[model samples]
Target: MGGSATRSAAREVILTLVVAAILIAAMPLLIGTYTLTVLVIYGMLGLSLGLIWGFGGILCFGQAAFFGLGAYIYAISAVNIGESTLPMILAVLLTAGFALLLGAMMFYGRLTDVYLGVITLVVTLILFKFINSTAGPQYVIGEARLGGFNGIPGFQTLNVPGDPGAYIWGDALYYVCAVALVIVFLLVTWLLRSSFGRIAVGIRENETRMALMGYDVAARKTVLFAIGAAIAGLAGALFASWAEIVTPTLFSLGQSAEIIIWCIVGGLGTRLGPVVGAAGLAYLEFVLGQQSMIDNTLIMGLVLVIFVLFLPRGLVPAIASLWQGSVGAFGRRRPVRRMRRARHG
Candidate 1:
């Protein structure tokens, strides 16, 4: 049983890597930079939620808070520093630090699951309102003006590392984002199969049991939460570069809700599931946005309801189930056919 399980896992990993390679190789030739860049950003956002909610069993409703925090940090820092290299690093670090502090407060306080979600939502709202109110010139952080509701614009965009002057845009930016997504995906996959990951999942499954086993449940949860935030921060930084602007909308309730929807729709728990979900739905939304007659929000809401009612495990899991069922049936039939042939002979 152990050997079989190992083989199955190995096969799954190889298949995931191969598929990722093929997609990366084909995306440059098939899609424009704008479309590809947006997909990459969405993919990272989905991954952030998928890691926290899917694996850590922490449903963070304020994931957008970290995302916005990262964007604002990057924008402000880049504007002040006149280069993106340091600002990008600061964005990720600050976001992770904030998550670590927030998670520590929540986990150590022994907040219940519902309360955790509520607190995250409230935190996001507070940030949104505060940032939205910062329309005055006094809200400036060095060279970067917090354009209040209008958002901070004209910040330095991401440039090549070391050179600082040469910008990565267009097709080059697409490749960078694509490569980043692939790396993040592979890292998350490896972590999920690691001992730390198993322990985290164990805590999610039965916190009491994991606690009794001498695991520091709160600490583990905090680390996972921070990791998720850092991933979201990376996404946010990329988004700011892609759009050449950062807005409080990044911290809006709507964005938070959408992130949750992506994770749920894509089939959470697996590494690639959220990416698949985020990209598929985002593209759908984009297409829907083009049609003057169709209300995109209504369509999305309906799709969510349909998925929850009929396909709770989500698209990836549903397809996996069908594949397994087909394989099982085929195997069973082969044995019966072999037995019949032997008897007839």
Candidate 2:
């Protein structure tokens, strides 16, 4: 029995490995640079949520603030310095800084799940209000309009030495984003399996016991929050490069809700599930939106309602279970039919 079980598990693993390899090998041929960029952004967004809500056990509703902050940080800095990489680095740092401040203040004050969620919402709304309302003055950053509601356009694209930018590229940015998505996925997966990750899991299970066990709960939460924000900031930079536009929408309540939906609709606690869910949903939205025959909002509403009702854990496991059930049902039917034939005979 043990040997059979082991062999069955190995077969499952091999099947999954083969499928993944084939899909990856054909991705460049199957998907264009634009589509690949969108997938990369989706993966990054998934990783961001999986870190905070999934692993850290923090239901952060303020991620869009960091997302917007990162984009603005990159855009504003690029306008100032006329470079992309520096702006991205600054965006990460600035996002981490704001996250540390917000997390320290809220977590240290003994805010629990619901209240913590509210605080995050408030933070993002505050950011949205400030940015959306404060644009339009002649505020100049040494000659560039902060651009305000109308974001700056005609920006210089990112370029590396001995290499071309995305605009002047042979799928370089797509490959860069693909590399980043894989690296971030592996890094976050490793983090979730580490000692720090265990402590996070402990906190998620029982913060009181973990705090009593000599762990600085607030500190750990704050640092993890910062880390999550930094990752989200990096995602925002990728998004900016992909869309070539940044807006106050990034800090809007809707934006925050989208991240929450992505996290919840994707299976929480598992890293890759969310990545797949985010990308799958995004791809569906994109494809449907392009078709004149379908109303995407209706499609999204139906998907959200059905998923929330039937598969609260989201699409990944839901689809997996459906596939398994189909196979098992057929097998069971074969056995039942043979039994019926024997009884009739």
Candidate 3:
């Protein structure tokens, strides 16, 4: 039974990869570069949140904190360094380190889920306000000034790893973002199939039980949180490069809420659900923002409510469940038909 289950999981993994490949191949042909770039960033943010909240059972409401931190770090460092390579690395590490510290404080305190969520939200808000107030020249970090609400602009954009002269932008930037998405997706998929991933999920499902089973629950959760933060940071770094600016708005409550909404609407606990949700909703938002006929917020809220009421399991998971049910029904019918033939013979 264990071997059979393992084989089934392997098959699912291969199937997922094939589907991803097909979708990615079709993206450039279907979507314009600008929209695709935004979608890619949103997808990465969703993926990061999905990993922690869905798989690790961490309800982080301040995910945008890490996202903004990464963007700011990248922008500042890139401005000073005259290239993106080192700054990109710095962003990921700094964000992950911050997550580690934050996670340790909460996990070690044994904070309830409610408290955890509140703390995260508060943290995000604090960052937003603090960054917004840093408009004075005294708020400078080396060559990069914290322009407060105005944001830091004219920073160095991303270039190739070795050759700083080969700036990545336009169509090339779009493809880079697409490729990054694929790599991160595959990496997370692989992680989910590993022992650490299984243990993390176990911790999520039952922390006490995992502790009794000799696992360091707090440490594991901290690690998972750090990983998620790192992914968000990567997304933020990319966003900074794409926009050539890092703003306090990146840490705004709306940004954090949108990340959660994307995860919930996409399908909590599923690998690709959040990505799908983020991309789909971001495109919808883009379209809605372009027109002045309707109240976009009202429409979005109504849509979210409808999804929560009608499709609680989310789009991807609901479709997956239906597909599995049909397959199961067909398999059962095949066995019954075989039995009938044998009896008749």
Candidate 4:
């Protein structure tokens, strides 16, 4: 039964990826490349938080810290090294390392969940303030200067592997972001099907029970947190490439809050919920941005409230429930119809 379940999960992931590939190929025809690209990056960012918070039950309020770190790290490194390949790698690894350190401190210290959230939020605020304060001319890292509120721009963006001069932008960058998001989605799905992932879920469900069952819950949580950070870092790197800039606003409280909202609005425990939430809400925000008649934050707050009160399971799970109910009703009606025909005959 276990093996069968694993196989089923694997098949589901494969099918999902195939569908994602089709959408990636088709979406460009329907939406502007720039809009789609930003949505893809945001979707990836949402997935990172969803994985750790939804599956591992680690509610990190500072995910944007990792995201901002990734962008800044990549920008700084790319500027110094004059190539993007190594900088992107550094962005992911260094961000993950930072998360691991922070996670270890929080988990092993036996901090309460509330405190964990507070600490993460505080850390992000600190980064935001510190980055903004670096406007002075002396604030320099190698060839790159921390431009403070102005942000770091004009850095080398993503390039084809083994060729630094072959810059990827516009449609190529959009495709790259879409493909990367899909790959991360697949990897996260596979991780959730693995033993470690199962253990992490169990820990999320009942931490005390898992601890009693000889699992090192702290270590597992720390590792999961780091993995999530790594993913956010990758998304940040992609965003940096697309925008060609890195700024302190990336670590702002608003950015962190937006990520949580995405996961909540999408569906907490499901894999696709975060992506759907991120893309849908982001597109909504984009549309709202073009109009001055409505306040974006007010609109988002209202949406969050509505979901929390009415559609608590989020859009995906709510839609899934409706679909299942309709299918079941149809099946039941078919059997009744067959019975009636037999009786009539």
Candidate 5:
């Protein structure tokens, strides 16, 4: 049964990836590359939080800190190295390393959920303020200037491996982002089906029980937290490539709140929920940006409230439930119709 279940999960992941590939190929015809690229980036960001909060039950309010750090790291490295390939790798690794240190401190120190959230939030604020203060010329990492709130712009964007002249922009960037998002999604799905992932979920569900079962709950949580940070860092690097700038605003509380809102509105405990929520809400915000009539934050708040009150399970799970109900109803009616036909005959 376990083997069969694993096979079934693998098949589902393959099917999902096939569909994603088709969409990635076809979406350019429907939406502008710039908009789609941003959506893809936000989707990855949402997935990062989803993996930790939804699956690992680790609510991190400082996810934006990792995101901003990744962007800044990539920007600084790209400026110094004059190539994007190594910089992008550095972005992910350094961000993950930071998360590992922070997570180890928090988990090993036995911080409760509330305190964990608070510490993460405080850490993010510190990063935000510190970055914002780096306006002076002295705040230089190698050749790259911190630039304070003005941001680091004009850094070399993503390029072909071993070729810095061939920059990836416009539709090519979109495709790259789409492919990266799909790959990350598949990896996260696979992780959730793994033994380690199952243990993480178990720890999430009942930490005391898992600890009593001889599991190193703290270590597992720390590892999972670092993994989430790595994913977020990757998304941040992508965003920097697309925008050509890294700024302090990336670590702002508002950015962090939006990430949480995306997960909540999309549906917690489900992989696709955060992605869908982030894309949908982000597109809505884009539209709202073109018009000054409605405030984006206000609309987001209302949407969050509505989901919490009426659709608490989130859009994905709620839709799945409705679909299952309709299918079951049809199956039941089909049996009744067969019975009626037999009696009539």
Candidate 6:
């Protein structure tokens, strides 16, 4: 059984790799520029959720606050400095700072789990409402208006240093987003395999025992919350650059809920699951939303219900089932000797 399980897991991993490669390889030719941009955005946001919910066990509801802040920061900084890269750096720093401060307040106070969740959610909603209500109150950032509810538009393209030729910044933007996603994913995966990450999992699995084991549980959670928020902020900046628009909608409760749904629907703990979930839902929304049926909303709700009700573990686990199901799909197959020989030899 152990060998079979290992073999099954190996096959599933291989399959996922192949699928990712195929999708990426086909992306340039199969999808239009707009679709490509959207997919990249989905992957980026999903990666953020993947890091926070999947590994850190921080079910933050205010990630959108960082996200929107990053966007506003990037937009504001770019307008002020007239440079794209500078805004990115500024956005990252400012967003990380915000996350750090917020985490210190909440996590230091020993608010965690459900209470932590509520605090984050409330904070995020407050941000959303504030931004929505104050889009155009106008602080002069180097002679540029924030444009408030109007947000910021017509931002400068990224300037790669020392490059000679003209570049389609849009395509470069997609690649930038993709490359960033890959790097962030690798980093998170490595972190999870580290002692610190293991401690996080220990907190996730059993925080009290970990605390008794002399771990600073609150500090750990706080650190993770900040780190996850930083990632989320980066994602928001990317989204702003890719879409060339910043909106209060970016910080809304809907945005927060969607990240949670994506993580949950994608097999929350796994690295790739949330990314896949984000991409899958985006695809579904794009395709299904084209119709204006009376029951369209109802159908979508039902689908969500069905997935949660019948397949609790989510899409990744369902995908892992493919190997087992394939074996069963053969019905009452060969003898053990034959099966072993076919599988190994």
lDDT of 1 at 295: 89
What lDDT is reached at residue 19 by model 2?
Answer: 63
Candidate 3 C-alpha lDDT tens digits along 1-345: 989857876786687668777876788788888778979999999999999998888999999999999999999999899988999999999999999999999998898689999999998988999999999999999998999999999988999997878999988898888888888887887787777887887887788999999999999899999999999999999999998888899999889989988988998888788999999999999889999999988878887899889988688767765675678954444444322221111
lDDT of 6 at 24: 61
Q: Compared with the true structure, what per-residue lDDT tens digits does model 5 show for residues 63-152? A: 999999899999999999998999999999999999999999999999978999999999999999999999999999999999999999
lDDT of 5 at 72: 91
lDDT of 3 at 1: 92
Model 4, range 17-101, lDDT digits (tens) per residue?
7899899989889889999999999999999999998888899999999999999999999999888899999999999999999
TM-score attained by model 5: 0.94
lDDT of 2 by residue, 1-345 (tens): 979845754574466557645665678797677887777777787778778887778999888888888877777777787767777788889999999999999999989889999999998988888777657766666545666677766555556733434352337777777767777765675576457877887787789999999999999999999999998898887777667777788788877766777766776666666777777778877788789887877887787777788778766555555675778954445444322221111
- Over 4 Å off in model 6, which ranges? 1-22, 135-137, 162-168, 294-300, 322-345
| Whole-model Cα lDDT of every candidate shown, in order | 0.86, 0.74, 0.87, 0.90, 0.89, 0.72
- In model 5, the Cα lDDT at residue 234 comes to 95
Ranking by lDDT: 4, 5, 3, 1, 2, 6
In candidate 1, what are the lDDT values of residues 28-118, reduced to their tens digit? 6776768888888899989999988888889999999999999999999999998889998999999999999999999999886899999
lDDT of 6 by residue, 1-345 (tens): 979866775675566557756766678786665677667667667767667666666788777788888888888776677667777788888888888888889877877679988988888888777766765555457655666577778775455643313333666766667667766766675566557877877787677899999999888877787777777778887788777788888888877767776777887667777788887777777777787774555654676687789876678756755654687864344444222321221
Q: On a 0 to 100 scale, what is the lDDT of residue 187 in model 5? A: 87
